[model samples]
Target: MRSWLLKSLYVLAALRYPRIRPDLRYFVRDNYFARLNQLRFWRADFLTKTPYKVVEFYGEFDQEIRYAMPFAYWHFLNGTLKQTVASKNTRPFYFFSPDHVEKYEKRVWEAGYGNYSIPNMTHAPTYDFSKWARVPFKSHYQNDVFVYDKPLLVIANKYNIEWDKPPINFLDIPALDRLISGLKSRYQIVYNRPLGGQIVHDNSEIMDLGEHAWLRTTHPEVLLMNDLFDQHAATVQNFNHLQLLVYANCNHFISMHGGTAALASCFGGTNILLSHPGGGFEHEFNEYNNLFPNLSGATILHAKSREEVFTLVEGRF
Candidate 1:
């Protein structure tokens, strides 16, 4: 009944606000139905028979890292009761699509929750991280097994929707070059470009979804970083596991404000998060600072100027 009402509201919104019709449609199709399914599951007591409590996290990339992963971690630390998480990326949610479920399922398995995880549930779980906002996240997972021999520095550059916004967290080619040049000598720099032009829902046509052709034209240095550093570059396609492994093992991480950075916070390494001042630094800073807490080596900084970013990166090294 509520779902039907929300669906009606979505139709009304589409009719009333044609300019944002696509965005509204997405909310109705993905967000609403996913939550409705979750409500139905809870009311039906579907997981009552299971030994471990199940948390169905059906959100996009940012939500998974920022909310879902932490929500699960908090529960793991606070209680002895075993718990599993169903981290779905199916329709209505665009971050982790069905095509990429295998990698995420492998991630869940590698994290020692193989028995507990249901990474690809078709019905999908609802997004309900607000309940765990006040709850603290501790670094209970260790990366000793995954650490590299040399000091590792991980960099995650985002050039997607942020490109349209004011230059806050987005780093241009020259800036990236300077940073990479300075750090390459001391630490093994691993670059991660997790998203690409392909849309998660449909893999056929290339869209201006992520770091489109702009990165190649403007920031060729990002592509050249691997050759310069004698290391293989990591992207969404082949390096999901290695990306997480490097994050877990890295000594320091430099990342743009997004899902990738949020995931890095889970590893409890020194993280320098660059945020755009005009892009809501105060909100991002407060949310991350609170979510990860003091113990977590996560620092959110305003990237108003390139000099500040350079200084922060240099200081970390």
Candidate 2:
């Protein structure tokens, strides 16, 4: 329903802003600063021979639109600003923030980009993080409220079996059971909310959503992005980036659909899906690879045996 409403809003926006109507994905939800980032990355001439001022405004926002930054700094910052007499040959970057935007704001500013605050982030209008925000930061709003004393066993969510197609497996009971059986001895378990583009209906008669089924049946405690869990305060407090950082730093594990493989690959952690048979979907067939070079790594292993799955994670810990 929320997604539908957002889509409707976009349709309405098309009528209101004809220029953005066709490229709503690049415009609509973006704030002025984020919009600028997209412009800069796409146009290189935006910068002069001088160094560019690249202000990075980061916070515990709900989501981070990392891809848009490259272009924004180039075109908007360097192009327009650099053309000005006072601003010529140098770049200035501004980041509006509510939380940790300061850290990023400072880093980017000190490194050459200028930082400026717009309005107080706490007062920013609340909306869905996926559609517009550069990075989701709801969890960052209440950082002190949640704490993790012991090592966390982070289990990210996978919306479905096949993102491009309907799900073939309705219940990944074996995967869940084996995960529990395999790691029960080594770690105190807690399932984390799954992020990334994988979308699954909580109740899908079609595609029989296997990932949702596993969460509903076995690890009823598993966190759903849509639903807040007991650790909702904590999870929200930590935001999703902290989870990634934790996984990157601590003794964490990954058992996800192939969508998460790139992060797992970069972090050097145990990604359970890597052991799947035939390495999941081969990306050579994926059409979007040209626009999104990252999708080329969509291939993952579909587990052939429970033992193979168990062995994959067992060695990682």
Candidate 3:
């Protein structure tokens, strides 16, 4: 009955935001519903704060970065966060908190990736992290280990499965060539495209772009993330750790959409996110504009096409 009522009310909200797909109407409404639950616990936060105030997530990396991390960090700031639970190799992200429990849920990854993990994070009005505490990943990881003589520029690329289609919003080799040729002289480029096993697997499969060898041969000056992970095998925990450390130093990024762009935004820089799809949750709620930037007050330039990418690169980067 409650689901039926929200579904009926969602029709009105959908008309106002018609870009959202029909199937996601309830998901968005449920987020707003869960958000309303916050008021019921507002008074409890100060007096009832306890070690039980934990946040667990095994969702899409993008949503995890946008919603789950900040939600947990907010609990940390409020002194209520006790133990964070998530998949493996994520301690680096939650190191600032009191405790983190790494428990990989490969089976549940299929259903994860929304504001459903915790109730407070269900708010629909905002994704702003300004009032919230920003996880000090950059300050904690930024060190002299990965310093470069030139200003570092990270091009975090992704070539994999996406709901929108093959050209879901990743840069092909030719476009990469254009960016590298244009920016390599001014910046020390670190090209990142994590292999499948390196990052926790999800529904999305990592399709081979076959660009690793091309980057080494075509632009030997450019750094590859896989090689860096190999070179600093003992120094960091995993590929995610290396990315945080390296990305912490740079202030400019050209990345594919989804988690790649979200991670880049967390470190505070100008992130050119290639997002062309029209009907994903990103477009549905239209919240990423605020959510991504507030992650660290980063400047985000959304380029809907490959041509616009270079245009923003020329003007912003």
- Top-TM-score candidate index: 3
- The digit string of per-residue lDDT tens for model 3 on 79-105 reads 777888888888889887688888975
Taking all chains together, each candidate's TM-score versus the true structure is 0.53, 0.40, 0.90
Ranking by lDDT: 3, 1, 2
Candidate lDDT (C-alpha), each = 0.47, 0.35, 0.77
**Structural RMSD, model 1:** 10.2
Consecutive 10-residue window with the lowest summed lDDT within model 3: 122-131
Q: Who is ahead in TM-score, 1 or 3?
A: 3
| Tens digits of lDDT, candidate 1, 202-248 | 11121232332544564453332323222433322334434544565
lDDT of 2 by residue, 103-166 (tens): 3211111211122111111111222222122221222222443335544455553444443455
In model 1, which runs have C-alpha deviations exceeding 4 angstroms? 1-52, 74-149, 163-168, 197-238, 281-285, 294-302
- Name model 3 segments beyond 4 Å from true: 1-24, 105-110, 113-132
Residue-level lDDT for 261 in candidate 1: 63
Worst 10 residues of 1 by lDDT: 115-124
